[model samples]
Target: MTQTLLPATSTESSSRPVVAVTGADGFIGSHLTEELVHAGYRVRAMAIYTSQGSYGWLDHVAPEVMQHVEVQLGDVRDAGSVRALMRGAQTVYHLAALIAIPYSYVAPRSYVETNITGTLNVLEAARDLGTARVVHTSTSEVYGTARTVPIHESHPLQGQSPYSATKIGADKLAESYFLSFGLPVVTLRPFNTYGPRQSARAVIPTIISQVAAGQRVIRLGDLRPTRDFNFVADTARAFRAVGEAGPEVLGRTLNAGSGREITVGDTVKLIGQVMGADLRVEQEDIRLRPEGSEVMRLLADHSELQALTGWAPQLTLEEGLRRTATWFTDPANLARYRVGEYTI
Candidate 1:
């Protein structure tokens, strides 16, 4: 009953093992799906099912790329659904979760259900299906306010917020599967990934949308905090690299980022420069994370990832911002977001 779009070459045998993506409708997931398709892989894209038939960002992917993708609808939290979606796939990229930090504060249980339980479902399904590889997505937020200048995979994980707490739990679950069941899983902990098609809940999209709407003041929080951001394309490529890496990387967590840190305030100024507009920033109470929950700095030490796969981020912060600003300024793309509102 599932539909797979294949190119003419696949009409002969279609022997390429299918790769399933669990959050294929999301920002990073959608990009990764497209990347996988472009790389000659048959992709089974699992968009979260909704009655309205919306495929999230997948609806915006170019039709040519869609030819190699099979868009399946399912929820990751449901083990049966996950197993069904991954039945014929050789690899799975588990990226489905409730990722908003503020929303986690409001609905901690939802974060637990989606992030923790959802990961468990993927692990169980992968193990049961004898999948060749699994790439579990992790966040830089798990390393709360860096204890070291450039955080490494060895850094102690701190759960400063509910979202990070659940993600930590999910990461531990992935590790448990690798140890207990010998599931071939690689955990990819990516720092802030920003670019077009990112939802308004994230900082980069929110700031770009607000500025593109001609707002005089940009509402932001904790300008002193810094982050290491990777462009979406680079991040997607990193996922593929991790997925295809040799057995040496099994059960290991790799960090993917630009290895460059920039403050939130400076990012605003940089976006202003990209947009060719003078920007003023205002701190909003609603935008601020709880005092102890704030992660003041995150700089990735992706030496392990680089050594393993020869992967490095391709775009500088300014270049990525320029492209993001251009996309957000387009009337068609701009219409998708409510620029005046705080999404969280």
Candidate 2:
């Protein structure tokens, strides 16, 4: 049986065309959803279905921001659900996925289904539904480690972990749809994205949450690895830019990043600097990725995206980290995380 989810609000009342976003309840997804709404676009925000009536990160979205949004409930893994969520949408930003690398190692099949098969469902639905545009989210992890200093779109894809492997498959599937079926899909590969509402599982959040909870020693793993981090707001803007870009971007993959890199150790120290804390570090084995699975470095060459959409990263790493740390300082927000626990 097909579940037909109509927009909860009437777009006919406004000139804005309705856009749908899968994973609209997660970190970057929620940020994108709110940004879309603020940008005066009508948004059909699809949160994963739950019996408890929760909307994940969206549950915390300001009531004013959600007024322009039509909240739909569905799973991206279900073809029927994906199709229903996408029908009548002019543009779709598909960000839903099982994203934890460590978790991917534990349950590879789940990653395959949710990331690969789920992406296939979106592409097929977009093709069938005649969706005007589809911005399929990709990640820097697909490049594994930096084979080159500044990785370009042409960089060879290496699946260093189950998470990245499935994403690679998903990206190829998106590319196939464009070549084979003429789906207007653009892949936006964002580097490490960090900001408010990011979960404890992420490194930035892990460091900050511990500090916010008054821990003097930060526990971490693989401090040698570096990442090209982008703030969630900047990443969200990049999505809109690609979604609104002309057909020149069709079937192309663009990188969304700061074009700068920082090692984990330096990043931790920066966070402490922003928080005015004198910090000690403890490297925990449990927090470490398997030797071969670790991605040692990532620096994005985002020139293509800038040349195409005139989009450049707005917030510096220090500024973004400061904002994120400030948010985590709220007792309510800080309480949501398990400060000292190592999240797999």
**lDDT string, candidate 1, 1-344, tens digits:** 11344544656226656899999999999999888887778789999888999999999988767767788888998888899889989899999999999999999999999999999999988888899999999999999999997999999999999999999999999999999999999999999999999988888888899989998588877789999988998999999999888999999999999999999888888888888789888888888989999999999999999999989998898898888888899999999998857788
RMSD of each: 3.3, 4.7
Looking at model 1, residue 81 earns an lDDT score of 84
lDDT of 2 by residue, 285-331 (tens): 99999999999999999999999999999999989998898899999
Q: Which 10 consecutive positions of candidate 1 have the poorest summed lDDT? A: 1-10
Clashing pairs in 2: none
Would you estimate the TM-scores of all the predictions? 0.96, 0.96
At residue 290, candidate 2 shows an lDDT of 90
113: Cα error in model 1, Å: 0.8
- Each prediction's Cα lDDT score? 0.91, 0.91
